[model samples]
Target: MTSSRSDTRSKIVDAAERLLREQGPTAVTTRAVAEGAGVQAPTIYRLFGDKDGLLDAVAEHVMATYVSAKAEIVRAASADDVDPVEDLRAGWRAQIEFGTANPTLFVLLSDPERARRSPAARTGMDVLRSRVHRVALAGRLRVGEERAVELIHAAGTGAVLTLLSTPPSDRDPGLADDLFDAVLRRILTDTAPFAEDGPLASAVALRAVTPALDMLSDAERQLLTEWLDRAISAASPVTR
Candidate 1:
């Protein structure tokens, strides 16, 4: 009985996913999905609650597969010793492509309330956080890991939305790349700075690994962390 119920749910979700992908969100009505999945409309209501509930299930299903593929790519790149900064760029480009290609899904996930509550969106953010952490370990990130992730995410989403608003033929091919570079400039150092007065980048990098350094006593580590935070704050760029 459990297996049969699960199968019914999968059929409905699969049908909804196809309708969303092929004809956009408006085509994913409960009646249409029930017809596509060869089930009665009440079956969809019993399984998914409503149209919004069904759409959420479809988003979760599709994005789970997409995020899993991206996770594998990141894992492979890390195992191969790809440059952390380059890997980050690759991830950024992949996200842009995904958003542009599936504008409907992208817009659905873009809803602030939905995005904040979404498991799939949180998984994607976790992936971004890991990539940013890698860059910080490499001494390339200039800002704190959380700040860098937030900046990159906002910039990438904005870039995709801007491009989507433009006609395909009239869209600037370099817009996304240019925006990415601009973000990189703000949040990452081209090279690790070793100077005494300009040790902010190094301080930020060291802070990421401080807990792993067993050589320092807890008190000593605390002192170092305080000092590093002051340095990082002093050197951080002021945003309007």
Candidate 2:
């Protein structure tokens, strides 16, 4: 019985996703979804509560599908063989493609409230965070991992939205790539740890590995991170 119910829920979500993709968010009425899925309107409410709830499920379904494919690609790549910065660039390009391809779903998930509540969004972010951590571990990151993640996320999200807002014929083909390079310039070091301002470079490198220090308590790590950020900022003219 549980399996049967779960199947029914999947069908409804699948139908809603198709409708949303084909006709946009405005067309995803409960009645339309019920007809598409061959289920009663009450079943949608029973399983998903309301239209907003159903939309949330649809967003999750689509995002999970995208993330799963990307996860497979990441798993297939040998970590030691991959350049972390290139890996990050590949992921960023994938995100841009996904967002532009699914404008309706992208806009829906753009809402801060919805994004915060989305399991799929969280999963996507976790993938991004892991990639950022890899860059840090390689000593290529110029800023704190969390700050780098936020900067990348914000830039990517803005680029997609900007492109979507423009008419396709008028959109700049290189805008996304330009924005990504700008982000990289801010977050990444050109060379690893031996350039001018060696102390700042060393501090940035150490901050990246702080999470792996088993001797430090959570508070100690946090405090250490703060000190490192301050030292890094003070020593680096670019960051000051």
Candidate 3:
């Protein structure tokens, strides 16, 4: 049977996502996405407005995938009861794997246009900053003040972007986790003393970020949460 218009629109998005993975965001034009989805270029425009809109859609798709994979990775690994340092290492490794597997989408996250146009990108930064603050609260990491969380995110994102931009040959992919682990370790070590002491301290620290999460409207949070779930469902895992 012929697909419905909604189905067709979804196919266009799927096509955009694929082309982005195969040829980077630059290849994902209305013409290209339409052709890939076997629809006319006008259909793509009708569905998404313009090239930037398409890119925004694709970015939405990619961010969703990252969040889902993150949830899975954390859920699976949470059973390990590892030390704070080891927990950080595992998280770093999962992030590197996710990035390497979706290099094109990862590259798109680094795009200035994405930062400019996508609410998901902004929400992601909020979530990450919250996580950092949580670590500080839990005593797993040391962050001296509220502002320190933003400073840590700046440095961490810098490390992540640098690692993403560098090819494996230049700096062995195996070392990405170790390199980030070291960066996080140094940051956390300095803040560990300020952390609250308790058996559930780390968990409590993570909750500290709830205030940040609460900043978004309920509708916005739900929309983002659903989008993230769909993105993960759409992403096919690949070996690097």
Candidate 4:
């Protein structure tokens, strides 16, 4: 019985998502979704409570699938030793494309309260956080990882929402790219750390890769990481 109910729930959500993607949010009425899923309207109400609840389930399902593919892409890029910046750019482009392609779902996630309640949303952030960590490991990040992730996420979300609000014909082709470049400029440096560049970037980078310093005893590695963390915190302009 539980399996049967779960299957029915999946069927309803699948139908709703298809409607959302092919048409728009307005097309996903309960009657339409019920017909699409070949289920009675009460079943949807029983399973999801209402339209808002149904939408939440759809958002979670869609984002979970997207994050799975995104994680694989990140893993493949890492295996290929792609430049960390390029990998991040690829991920950024993927996000923009996904948002624009699924405007309704993206809008659902635009709400901080809803997104915060989503495990898939948090996993998506972890992927972005890992990418930013790589940039720090490459010694090109000028800011701390948490700050950089926040900035990039905010810019990307705003860029997608702006594009979605405009008609496709009226949208600027370069807007997303320009915003990404601006975010990168704020978060990254042109080159890896050098002696003259000061200690912040180097400290950030060293802290990132500190776990791999296997020659040191665990206690020594811990001490070094603590020192690097202090140096990075002191030098990060945002921290002050």
What TM-score do all the candidates reach, one by one? 0.91, 0.90, 0.63, 0.91
lDDT of 4 by residue, 13-55 (tens): 9999999999998998999999999999999999999999999
Query: What lDDT tens digits, residue by residue, belong to model 1 across residues 1-240?
Result: 999999999999999989998998889988899899999999998988899999888888878888988888888987898898899999999999999998888888899988988898999999998889888888876677778999999999999999899999999999999999999888877563454323667878998898788999999988888887777776776331
Model 3 residue runs over 4 Å out of place are: 1-5, 75-84, 116-119, 126-134, 144-152, 164-167, 190-240
| Predictions in order: lDDT | 0.86, 0.86, 0.60, 0.90
> Which ranges in model 2 have alpha carbons more than 4 Å from their true place?
78-80, 215-223, 233-239
Model 1 misplaced stretches (Cα beyond 4 Å): 192-198, 215-227, 238-240
Q: Model 3, 35-91: lDDT tens per residue?
A: 899999988888889987887787787787666565554445445544545544555
Clashing pairs in 1: none
- lDDT string for model 2 (53-84, tens) is 99999999999999887776666553455887
When 2 and 4 are scored with lDDT, the better candidate is 4
Candidate with better TM-score, 1 vs 2: 1
Model 4 poorest ten-residue lDDT run: 189-198
Give the total clashing residue pairs for model 3. 1
lDDT of 2 at 25: 90
